[model samples]
Structures are given as structure tokens and as C-alpha cells.
Target: MATGDEFPLPGSTYRGPAPHFARFRAEQPVVRVPATGGGHAWLVTRYDDVRAVLNDVRFSRAASYAPDAPRFPGLFQAPPGMIISLDPPDHTRLRTLVAQAFSVERIEGMRPRVAQLVDELLDRADSEAVTAPVDLLGRFTFPLALTVIAELLGVPSEDQERFSVWIRQFAAVDGPEDEAIAAREQLGEYMAGLVVGKTAEPGDDVLSALVRARIGEDRLDVGELIGLGYTLLGAGGDSTACQLASSVVTLLARERDTWVRLGEHPEEVPAAVEELLRWVNLPTNDTSGLPRITVEDVEIGGVTIPAGDAVFVSITSANRDEAVFGSPDELDFARGGEHLAFGHGIHQCLGAPLARIELVLALRELTRRFPAARLAVAEQELRWQPADMNHRLLELPIDLHGKGF
Candidate 1:
């Protein structure tokens, strides 16, 4: 087995996609690599092969969490039966129930609020602009994403900070395992109480709506409700924040022209947003996207993956596949094409609509207000966490005064 540990995989130290991903794509697109837990599994790096693993019904995400299932190192296993850990039927049911809150109408109605929130956040960042090099991740993007999800879920403002802290620990890949588990439990307990309270005095928020949402006379139970909350906040908040921050970082560092185009022609922001989503390498290069297991023998790129073998799909590499993308590394909004940043098939991200709205609005406003914004520190000096969950920067020190707002 070629462990590939000799390669520089993205984690804390390496900031971009590991060079090995491209090499693997060329030499061995689908090969067995060491699993994080303790065994060998297939690592699919090519674009088409990744889509196969993601869309094929034979590959089971739910089974990947089985007691005897295999997991890659440092990959956190979601509690069994969690919405993200389920396959059809159960996943279908939960997704349907949760869809009420994130419907197109509901998210579209949030545009004004989203814009308002962006303005408020930028106002704060501008005030701190007196102290050049504001930490965009800590001060803006992270909080903005968390706050949006919190408000959407009807979490009280007073509780959002504490709630976000618990979530950070729970979702963190590098944190202590016990603490992350405890944080998850605490969040579940807190959400349960909140649900009960909302049941008594329902408000105009997602949680309140969730408390009332049903599926053929089957309402969400406390456990399912808590699990839903975890899925929403975890998936919707942390990952989106990291993605938003990385988009900005990548644009400032490598796609300055694209960033300028958005600033000059805000009308193009929507189209530009999609390209940004496709371009930014989530978690790390060759995203350790959601892990799935093969239920039956499956072959991809001429490699046979045995049943029960963990198959890790690299979205980062897929987005850059040379066959699908011309000049794959370049960030060109004109290079419009579908990319699987949101995980391809049935389990595609539920919060994708809202995430797109946030990213588009964020980039639009940031560019309009500070057209001259650039990295305060050199590109190579920027720090990145080494994990496969979301490509996140430790800090984004940026000069917010591009041509003096």
C-alpha cells in the first residue's frame, strides 16, 4: 500500500493543495491509501472518479459510520444515525422535514437581512481599520456566518456567542476528542431546551418553524431535533465560514483581477461567486470531503474497491481536473461550469442556497466598500490550519482601505 504519508498533505503547515494530488491524478487516480483509523482504503483523485463515488448508490455514507466501518485519520465520525450519517429513506425523511426552513422562498426573503448584516459587520471592521490589518476571519467572516445561521435558527443573540463557542469545539478537527464530544452533547442539550421553549412560545425563526414542521403527521422528536440542529449549525456555519474566508484569501492572493472585476461591476458578483466557490480549495487541497463506504465491489479508474472499504473523494482535486477545467488553477469567472464544492449527489449540502447568498453578498459588499483591500501580510506568511474539513485560515490580516473607502 502506498500510504502517501511521504507527501505533504494539507493540514496546519501546508496552505494549499498538496502537490501529490495532481501527481496522484495523473499516475494513480484511484489507489489504496492509509485510512485515518487504521486500514487501507481507496483514495479517488480524478474528477470523473470522484463524481462516480459521490453519485453511485453502491457507495454508502451511512455505512461509513458503522461500528466496524473504516475512517481516515483525523476524520471525525458523526454519531451514528445523525442526518449526515444516514442513507436514503431516513436521510430522505429528515431532509424533507428540514427543508421547510431552507426553502428558496425563505432564503430569498433573507437577502435584505443578509445585506444588513454585512453592512454592520463591515462597519465594525472599518472602525477597527484605524488599526490596519484587521483579522477578517476572527472579526468578520467567522462571526458573520455564525450569526446568520444563528438568526436563521432563531437562536437568541445573547446565546449565539456561547453557542458558537461550543460549536467551534465540537466541529474542530484538531481539538481534543473528549472536549469536542462534550461540546456536541452540550449543544444538543441546549438545543433540546430551546426547542421545548419554542414549542411554548414560538417565534418567527427557523427553529420555531422546525418545532412546527412535520412529515405526514410525524413531527421531529427531541433527539432528531437536536441532531437536525447540529447538522444545520455545523454544516451551515463552520464550513461556510471557512469557505468564505478562503475565497477572499485566494482572491486577494491569486485572483486579484477577478476581485477587481467584482468591485468594478457589482452586477457580475453573482456569476463571480460561483467561480469563487469552484476555485477555493475547501479544507485543504484535495478536500477530504464526506467519507463514504462501498456497499458492494466498485471499480473506478480501473481500480476495484472492495465492499466495506472507505472511499475518500477529493473535491479539491476534482474541481481542478484538467479535463473539465482549462487552466484549472486559474480563477476565471468566465470559466463557468458545475463543480462539486457542495458534495455532488443526494447528500448535497442542504444549506447551499443560503451559503451562496452569503458569499455573494459578502464579496459584493467587501469589494464595493474597499476596492483597494489587499493582504497585509505576504501570501506565504499567511497561516492555515492543516485539516481536511474546511480550508480555513488562522487569521486574515487585510488592509481594508483600498483607494480609501
Candidate 2:
């Protein structure tokens, strides 16, 4: 396989994923490339090849996290006990323990609460917008995502503001290395305390459940508990927050008809949300969804990746694969099929159900409230978060345009 551009590439909020992803998907499904952080590894762009890599056990997440593992230059290493760094059956065991909290029943149970939160947030947006355009990323999306996850995890509502600061730094892709490290350490310490508090005064929230959750005879140790907290904050809060902001921007600014369509047919909002998730490629620099290392020689897309090689699967590109979704770049809610936005296989996003609920509710309410919402600033003038693996808007400044009613 030929080598492509350096991984991580440069962070560009104004632009989307590298155009080379399309070219590579059309030509070389798999190729090696210099990692943005430092080292070089295989970059897989095709939808089929990416799905194969994610589903294949030969491509090991554990090996990718090994101390002696090949790394993508400057990427932050996963701390011990973080579930994302673990391999099965450890991963399976840990996932099983927390899976109940995110079960279909539990997430479904959250709909009313989530909708209420969205309504309150939009109310606040309206109040704030009386003077000027409100930045939804801060005023609505970030708070909504973080608050929901915090409430689920038993984090104090008052502390969410503080937690958000640390999480943003920790999740930033272009932030200083020292600041990120500091943020992680600080957040870890905070989670440790939070877990202990929950253990002592166990509540009805997810973290309390996790603190006491068991898989037969085993339970999460303190380290694992802390790690899980970290995961939830970063994954549930950070990623989903970005997704929410991007969804609003994409729907309102780029796909206004889709927005109008959903507003007209509220029943189709769920399917529309899925399509938006697939089509909106926030500014991303992480070529791979998360770097995986080949446990052995594995052939993907006719190219063999030997054991110990870091492989990055381009999910953004896969979601846009022309083979799977004709006219891949277009956002057609009616044109739906399986997409890898939430990934596939064992490590598929654990919070997908919650994210879907949040997005659906947010879209339903936003369309109901502000069908005419439009960007207050030019699309080109908007800035994006320089986050690693995150494609978040720095702020979604928008005018509500006097609400839908």
C-alpha cells in the first residue's frame, strides 16, 4: 500500500476532512501514512474496508494501547483502566457491567427528561437572544449534552460548569500538551472523589449503579471506576456536544429544506437525525476513528497489515463512501442505510441510544421553536474547536429569527 499524507494532518475548522479520503477510497482503499502525532501507519478509507477492520478481532484495540505499541506520533495515550484501551474479554466484562444503564429501556425512559431539558435550554436561548444572537454551542448544545451525561453519572449539577472546562481542554485536539495533561489529571482526581462519594451515598443515577454494578462476582475496582467516569465525560459529554452543535449548523445552514421537511413531518425526525449524523462531517483531523493495531498479519482491501502496525480507519470517509451511499456527500434524510458514524462491531458507541434520543429531541424542539433559525455569522467566518478527534464548532452563533410560531 502506498503512504498517504501525515495523520492528524493540520487542524482546519473551515474545511472538512481531507479530500484525499475520497481519492483514496476510490483508488487505494488502504495505504500507509505518517501519523499527525508522529509515527506512520495504515490508513483505511473505504466503507467496506473500514467496517472489516473494526469488526475483525485481528485488529486489536489492546495491542494499540500497549506500552511498547507503535503510536501515531503525539497522540495522547489512553490511561490504564480506560475501557477504550482494553481488549475483550476485559472489554466485554466491563461493558456488560455498565451496559444496563444505557439499555434501550433506560434510554427510552430518558426521553421526557431530555425533551424537558431541551425545552428549558431553548427558552434560555430565546431570553438570551432578545439582546443579540446567542451562541448555541455554549448556551445550548454543550450544556445540554454535558448536563444530561452529568445527571446520568450522578455528577452534581452545580459542578458541571467546572467539569466542562476540564473536559474541553482534555478533549481539545490542538490544545497545548501540558494543558491537556493537566486537565486529564485534574479530571481524574475529581472523578475519583465523585466515585467515592457515590459509593458512600449511592443514588439512583448511573454512576451509583456503576459503583455498585457487578458482573457475577466481580465489580469495577476504584481505578476502573475512575476510568469509566473519564470515559463517560469525554465520550458522552464531549463528543455528543459537538455532534449536537454540528447537527444544528448543518441542518439550519446547509440543509434548510431537510430542516423544513422534518419540521413538517415530525414523525420522520428520527430517520432525519440518522442521516444528519452520517452526512455532517465536522472538522476532523484524526484520520482513524481511533488507532487500532493489527494483532497479526491481516489482509484488508487486498493490502496486508502486519502485526503491530497502527491502523487508522477514516469513519468520516466511510460514512461518505459512494459505493455504500450513492451521492455520498449529499444530506438526503430519505436516502438511508447503515452508516459507520457510531462505528460498528464490539466497540460501537455505547451511548448511541442516548445520543439518538438527544439529537431527535433537540431537532424536534428546535424545528418546532425556530424553523427560521439561521447562522448569525457567515459559515466561512465561524471557528471550530481545534480538538483531537473532535469536530466541534467553537460556537454556534445563530439568530432564532423570531421563532417558528
Candidate 3:
């Protein structure tokens, strides 16, 4: 394919994967292409193939960090405690320390509080929406996600805004690299202080739990502790904000009946969230999925990627692969299939349970409040952030007076 065009396979925020992936799935399921980070890398698109690359131990996430290793620019995850960058023993060791907090039971227990927060935010929006429409991205989705993560991590109320500000800057794909670096350092410094505080007097939060956590006699040192905290806070907050916002836009603009039906029957929300996860493809990777190097030759989608070559498996393309998913582009709530939205294998998102809870509860509650909601402005007025990494809608001016969008 001569490293066709550039990489990342261009995608749309509102629409799913660009037409490119479908063609890639049908034709060259595995082909070499130029990556965003300045190198030719293999792009793997079919369903089973993408799943294979994700699960196969031969595809090394850890080794891709070597200076000479070929990789696409993804999460600038080059820190001591970044679990996504680690493999096997190290990843397993760190993940165990904080695993309990996001257990399904723990997250489900947070439902009442999540519902309460949603309602409170809605109440404030209701009062404020006398004439003007509310920016749901700002007022509802972002706040709902930020507050849930902040409270779970025990970020004090006063410091949350600062934490949020730094997080937004750090997560912004559109921002200057230097600014993101500065914000990253700021977040680390703040989290370091928080870790110190947690050590002195622990609280009933994830950070404090980590403060007391130990693997036998070994404990996370200050740098690793800060790194883990940074990873969780950055990932848990902004990613959810972008995803939930994108999902809400999907419901309001595209799937009105599903929205109304869910509003009337909140119990169905849990099931629907799975389909939503499958349907809304965000981190369709602005660069690509933390490129993995093949430890040995890997036969994926019929292509034998030689050992030590960087490969990117497109989850977005896989989720919509017609072979695995019938009528892949159509958003069917009744669809029955496991989707790789949270990813697959050992590295699936640790926060999947919490993300599902937020999506389910937020949508369930939101529909009840604004069943008639539709776009406040014409569809053209809706703006999505430029393609950097994930699909993100910038501002959704939702008219809550009658219905909502």
C-alpha cells in the first residue's frame, strides 16, 4: 500500500468511523501505513484481527517504549506508574492496588450519589435556563463526570476547579504541547501534595486507599503514587467528559426514540449503555492505540507482521466490522455482541464499570427530565473539536425549557 496517505485513518466525530475503515476491513485488513508520530506502522482493521493484536502477548505494549521502537503518538504515557505502558508482572502489580475501588459493587453503590448529582446539576440548569439554552457539555455532561471522579478520588471541593483546569489543559489534544506538559507537571505536584496529606490523615477515597495500600511489604513510592494518581485522575475525568458529551449528542440529535424510550423506562439503560459504547467510537485514537510491537511474527487478518514491528489495531473499525456485527453502522440497542469499546485483553479500561454507571445513570435520569429535548439550534450550529485524538463535541446548547438537545 506504500504507506497510503497518512495514518490514523481519518474519522468523524458525529458519524462513526470514516468510510476508510470499512474499506480497509473489506480489502487490506492489515496494511503498512505512515503513523502520525513519523514512521511507517502496520494498521490492523478486521474484527478478529484487531481482537487478536489486542490480546496476543506477542504484541508488546512495554517494549514499544524503547527509544528505537516504532510507535504512533498516543497517550504520552512515558511515566513510572502509567499502567497502560507496562506489561505483565508490573501492570498486574500496580493494577491490584487500586482495583477494589472500581469493582462493580463499589461503582454500583455510587449510583444513588450519581443520580443525586445529575439531578442537582439539572436543577441548577433549570433555574438558569429562563430564556437561554444551557451548554449541556459544560453544565451537565462535563460536570457530572468531573464531580463523580473527583468525589471518588477525594479531591477536595475547593481544589477540584484547579484540578479540573489542569486536567482539561493536559487532556486537550488541541492545546500547545508545552502547555500540556506544564499542566501535567502542575497536576503531578498537586497530586503529590494530596498523597502526602493522605499519608498524614487518610480519607474514604481512592487516593487514601492507595496511601494505605501495599503489596506485602512493598508500597508505592511517592513518584509512582503520583503517577498512578495522575493516570487515574487525567483518564477518569476528561475522557469521560468527552465520551459522555459525545454520547448525549448522539442520543439527542440522532436517536430521539431511544432517548424517549429510555426516559420512560430507566431500567433499560444498563443494556443500552453497552450498545452506546459500541456505537460511539471516541479515542478512535487521534494518533493510534498506543502502538504495540510484535515480539515475533504475528498472523493477523492474513498478514504476517514480522517481529519487532509496531502495529495499531483499530478498535473502532473492529466494533463496526460487518462480519462480527450485523449491519455495523446502525446503532441497535437490541444488538447482542461483546464490543471492544473498553478494549480487550489484560489492558481493558480499568474504569469501564464506573464509565458504564455514569453513562447509564446519566442517560436514564436525563431522559426522564427532558423527554422532548431536541437541538436548541440547527444541527449546523453544533460544533465538534477538530480531529486530534477522540471524537468530541465542543458545545451543545441544549434547550431544556420544553425538551432537550
Q: Write the per-residue lDDT of candidate 1 for residues 67-166, one digit (tens) a residue.
A: 8986555665577767778888888888888887677898888889999999999999999998677999988898898999888878889999988889
Of candidate 1, the 10-residue stretch with the lowest lDDT total is 6-15
Task: Look at candidate 3 and give me any clashing residue pairs.
Answer: 286-389, 372-403, 373-403, 373-404, 374-404
What residue pairs clash in candidate 2, if any at all?
Answer: 7-34, 7-36, 37-73, 37-74, 38-73, 39-73, 173-387, 173-388
Error of 3 at 119 (Å): 1.0
| Model 1 C-alpha lDDT versus the unseen true structure | 0.79
Ranking by TM-score: 2, 3, 1
- Comparison by lDDT, 1 against 3, better one: 1
Please tell me which model should have the higher lDDT, number 2 or number 3: 2
Candidate 2 off by > 4 Å = 1-4, 10-16, 286-288, 402-405
lDDT of 3 by residue, 50-106 (tens): 777777888988988788787455444445348787888887887787674456677
Q: What TM-score, over all chains together, does every model reach?
A: 0.93, 0.94, 0.93
Model 3 regions lying over 4 Å from their true place: 1-4, 71-80, 284-288, 403-405
